[model samples]
Target chain A: MKGLKIIVLAKQVPDTRNVGKDAMKADGTVNRAALPAIFNPEDLNALEQALRIKDNYPGTTVTLLTMGPGRAAEIVREGMYRGADKGYLLTDRAFAGSDTLATSYAISCAIKKINFDLIIAGRQAIDGDTAQVGPQVAEKLGLPQVTYAEHVDKIVKNKITIQRRLERGIETVTAPLPCLITVNATAPECRPRNAKHLMKFKHAKTVTELQSAVEDYYKLHEDRPYLRIPELSVLDVEADTNWLGLAGSPTKVKAIENVVFAAKDAKQLTADQKDLDWLMGELVANHTLG
Target chain B: MNNIFVFCEIDEGKIADVSQELLTKGRSLANELKCNLEAIVIGSKLEGIESEIAPYGADTIFVADDKRLEFYLTLPFTTIIVDLFKKQQPQIALFGATSVGRDLGPRVSSALKSGLTADCTSLVIGNHEDKKEGKVYENLLYQIRPAFGGNIIATIINPDCRPQMATVREGVMKKEIINKNHKSKVVAIDVNKVVTDVDFAVEIIERHMEPRKIDIKKSQVIVSGGYGVGSRENFKLLYELAHVLGGEVGASRAAVDAGYVDHARQVGQTGVTVRPKLYIACGISGQVQHTAGMEESAMIISINTDPTAPITKIADYNITGDVSEVVPRLIEAYRKHSK
Candidate 1:
C-alpha cells in the first residue's frame, strides 16, 4: 500500500495549567513572558496519532503545520524530535489579531499548498479552549470532520475508522480518507523525543530565526538543506489580504474584566475539637446537613 | 426577519436540559430585543416535541424530523442549520456547549462565514461602539466567557454578523418555564432539500451511551475536593464525608485532571457547573474556574490549609486545616451531632 501523507496541526500555547502569580500582568492582561510556552497538550496527542500512522504504514510521512509568531517554530522542531518528517511555520504580520474563523482561513490556504490525505489537530488549544479551529478549517476546505476522536482504529481501502470519545459514551465511526480529525486528550500520550532525532533537528531554524541569529549558520544551513525549516508568509499562501486578520474576523472583544470575587462574611474556624463540634451543631440546626 | 434562535439538542426522545436552558435564556433576550423566539430541533420521532419547548416561551419551533438524522451526523445537521439560518436571518443564535453543539456550531459558523464563541458563562444584549471604525452597533449579543485560563473575563461581540452565535455550557443558565399553557407554532422543514446523499458519508458503526451514574448537578449537598487533596486515596475521604452527610462527592477540574476522580464529578468551568445547597470544599484553592461552578451554592464551607485561599473569600465558613484531618473529624462530628 502506498503510504498516505498526513499533516498534524499544532500550536505553541502558554502553559495555562501552571499559571503563577506573575502569569497575569497588573492590567489583567496575560504576562506572556512569565509563562513558559509548551506544545498544546492535546496537539501532542494528535501528533502521536500521526506518528502511529507513520509507524504502521512503512512509507507514510507526517508533516507538522502551525500558525503563530516566529517563536512557534520551536514546536515544529519539537514535532521533528518526536517523529514528524518536515514542518512549516505559517507566520506573517498580516495574520495578527485573527479570530478562529480568520485563523482557519489562513491555515486552509496553507494546507492547499501541501499534499495530504489526512489532517489531524488537537480538539482545542488550552489558551483559547474554543475547539473551533479544526472544524472551521474542515469547513473551509469542504472536508468531513470527526471531533473528539480518541483513536484511529485502522485504514483500509481509502476508508478510515475512528473511535470518538463523547460526554455520555463512546462511538465508533468510519469515514473516507482525506478527512480532518480533532483528537481528544484521552488519546495516548505522545512518545518522548528521540535522542537521534533531537540531535539532528535541534539546530533546525526558521528563516526568521536564522535572520536574527548572531551565529553564522548560513553556510551550514546551505550544506544541510534539511536544517532549514520553511516559513510561509501570507503572500506565499496567496490568501486574500481581506480575509487574513482582524479585518476578516467577525467577532470583536467588547470588554475585558479581571475576575473579582465578592467576599462573604465568613465565620472563621479551626481544626480544634471545639470548632468542629460548633460547626456540626450549627449545620444541623440550620438543616444544612441531616 | 431578525429573530433569536436556539438550536435545541434532543437525546433519545427528550430535549436535553441544556437546550431548555438556552431556550429560557433566548426567550428573555428575545423579549428584550422585541423579537420572536424560535427553536430548531432536527431528529427522528420528534413528534409532539413542541409541547416541551413551548413552556420555555418559544414563539416558533422548527422541526426537521428524518430517519437519517435520528442520531447526529455532523454534515447533515450543519447543512440543515446553515441553510435555515441563511433563510431565517436570525439576529442571535445560542447553542448548548455539548459534544454535539461544539462540533456543529463551529462548522455551521464557518459555512455561513459568521462568528461563534464557545462555552460562554453569560449572555447579554448590549451596544458596541467602535472608535477605530467610527461605528456603533446596537443591541449586539455579548458573549461573556472566562478567557486566558479563567484569569480574565472577556465579552465578545459580532458586530457585522447576522445570527451572532454563541454556545453556553449547561447549568450555567437557569431553566425556567414561562407558562405551562403557552402555545407555539410548528414549522416542518423539508430535509431532503438541505441535505444530500453525500452528507451521510460518515457512518456510525457502534454506539454505547452509558446512563449517567454520577449526577452531582441534582445533589442538594456536594462534598468536593481539589488538587490540594493530594491523591486518589485522599479523595476517598471526601466520598466518606459525602456519604455521611447524605450528599454526592464532587471534584475540582484540578482533581479530575489529576485522576483523583471521574470527569463526571468535576465541578468547574470546564467540567459541570453545580449549585448545590451545601458545598463543602476540601483542600480547594478555588481558582475562578473552580469557584465559578460552586460559588453560587446556597452555602459554602471551605477547608484548606492556607487561610488566604481564594475560596475563603466566597465561602460562608472558612475552616483553616488540612483536608485529611478535618474531613474525618467533620464526619465524626456530624455523626455525633445528628444522632
Candidate 2:
C-alpha cells in the first residue's frame, strides 16, 4: 500500500550488436570513437522494471545511478525522461579501469550514501558481459540478490516476488526489502520516453557538463535546482583510493589480441550449378549428408 | 591446503553437465599445478554425489546437504562456499557460467575479496610478469575470454588474489573421467555453522523447469544463418535446407536479435556451443563469438558474398554468394545427388 524508494543502476555502453568496419583499429584495439554510444539494452529492461514499480506505487520514487565518464550522465537524463524522479552520475578519474569487483565496491559505497529499499540493474553489460556486478554489489552491501529476473510479480509485507528466467525454465522467488535484483532482457521492453518528462529534463546536466558549457547558465541552474544533476566523485562516495580503480582490481589483463582463426585452406567455390553439384557430390561421397 | 576447487552444481538429482565439465578441467589444472583437485556440492539429499565426482579425479569432495540449499539462494550458497574456500585456501576456484553459478560466483568472490572472470573460453596454466611490480608469477590460471563484443581475446590473471575464480560456459570444455574406480576423500560441511538464519532471507515460492525444446547442441547437421540472411522470410530458406538435409536450423546472435529466429536456436558465445558433424553457415560473417560455438564442427561451409569474411578462413569450403541463391542450389544438388 506504500511507495518504495528504488535505485536503477544503468550504463552507457557502445552498441556492440552492430559493430561496423571502423569498430576495430588496425592493431585490433577498439575504435571507440567510431562506435555509437547508447544506453545498455538490458539496463533499459531493468529501468522498465523499476518504473513499473513506481507506476504501481503512487508515492514511489525511482532514482538512476550510473558510473562512467561525464557522457554517461546522458543516461541519467534519459532515465528521467522515462519517469525516474532523479539520478546521480558517479564520475571520477580514480574510478577508471575498475574490474567487476572494484566497480562493485565503488558502487556499493555510493549506494550506502543514498537511501533506498531496492536496487535494480541489468544482468550484465554488453561491453563486459560479466554479469558479476549486481551480485558483487549485493554481497558488498550484505544484501541478498535475485538475478536473471524476468518480472517482479508483486510486493507485499516488505517482500518482493520475482520471476527468474533460468536456462531451463522459470522460477519464482521472494526476498525482503532492501535487497537487489538484476533484470534480464527477456523481460518487457522499456516504455518510450514521455514527451512531458523529456521536455522538462532535456536541459539537465552534470557539473562537468555545466563547467564546459559554451554559455553561462549558473543563474538558470540557481533558479531551476532540478536541472542540476548531482555528479559524485570518488571522495564524495567516501571510497578508499586503494579500492577504487585499477589498483583495487584484482584481475589484470595479461594480454589482448585480435581474434584470428587459423586458416584451413578452404576450397573456394561459386554459386554456379557445376560448383554446387561438385560440392554435393563430394559431401554425398563422404557421407556428410544424405 | 592450496587446491583447485570446482563448485559443482546440481539440478534435480544429477550433477549439471557444466559442473562435470569444470570438474574435468579442474582435474587437469590440478595435475598441471601438482595440487589436489577438490569439488564442493551444496544441496539437499546429495548423499551419493561423490560417486559421480570421484571419476573426474577430484582428490576431495565437500558436500553440504541441507533442505535450505536444495534451491539455490544466493546468500546461503555464497555463505557456504566462502566459508569453505576461506579454510581450504584453494589456489583456483571454478564455476559454471549458468544462472546459479553467475549469481553465486561473484557474491563469493566479493565476500572473499577475490577476482572472477566470466564466460571464459579457455583456462591454461601460465606465467605472468608484472612489469610495474617487477614480480614474476608462475603457474597462474590464464582466464581467457572474448572481450569487447568478441572483437578481441583477453587473457586475465589475478596475480595478487587467492582462489583465482572464473566461470566457463557449458559445452566449452570437454568432460572426461580419469578412472571409473577412483575414490575421493569426502568432507561433510556443518550447514548450521556456515549458513545462518539471515542466509534464508530469500524464499522460493514456485519453480517450473522445462526440458529444452530446441536443442541445437545435439544436432548432427546444422544449417545456420546470420544477419546477412536479410529477413525472417529468408530464414525459411535455411529451414527448408535443414529440413531437406535432415539437419537443424541455427541462427547467429545477430539474427536472433533481429527477430529472425528464436534465441534458442542461436549459435555463438552467448548462446549454445555446438559441435555438429556438418555445419553450413549461410551469410554469416564469422565473428569470434559465433565461431567459438561451431568452429570444431567436423566440416564447415561458409556462404557469404564477402570473400574476406572471417568465417571463410576457418571454413573447409567457402562459397561466395548470397544465402538465398546458394542455399536453394545446395538443397537441389543434395536432393538430386541423394536420389
Best-matching candidate per lDDT: 1
Q: Among all windows of ten consecutive residues in candidate 2 chain B, which has the lowest summed lDDT? A: B146-155
Cα lDDT for residue A225, model 2? 93
lDDT of 2 by residue, B1-339 (tens): 999999999977899988998998898888889999999999999989998999999999999999877888888888889889989999999999989999999999999999999989779899988777899999999998878776567889999999899998876666788999999999999999877898899999999999758888866689999999999999999998887675789999999999999999999899999988689999899999999999998789999999999998889999999899999999889878863
Model 2 bad stretches (over 4 Å): A18-34, A261-290, B217-339
Per-residue accuracy of model 1 over A165-208 as CA lDDT, tens digit each: 99889999999889999999999999999999998888899887
Q: Per-residue lDDT tens digits of candidate 2, residues A1-290?
A: 69999999998988886666676655333555677899999999999999999988888999999998888898999999999999999989898778999999999999999999999999999988999999999999998899999999999989999999998899999999989999999999999999999998888998789999998878888988999899999889999989877789999888776544333579999989789999988876554553
Compute the DockQ of candidate 1: 0.42
lDDT, model 1, position A224: 87
Error of model 1, residue A120, in angstroms = 0.1
lDDT of 1 by residue, B162-281 (tens): 789999886666678999999999999999988999899899999989986778987767999999999999999998888667688999988999999999999988889988768999
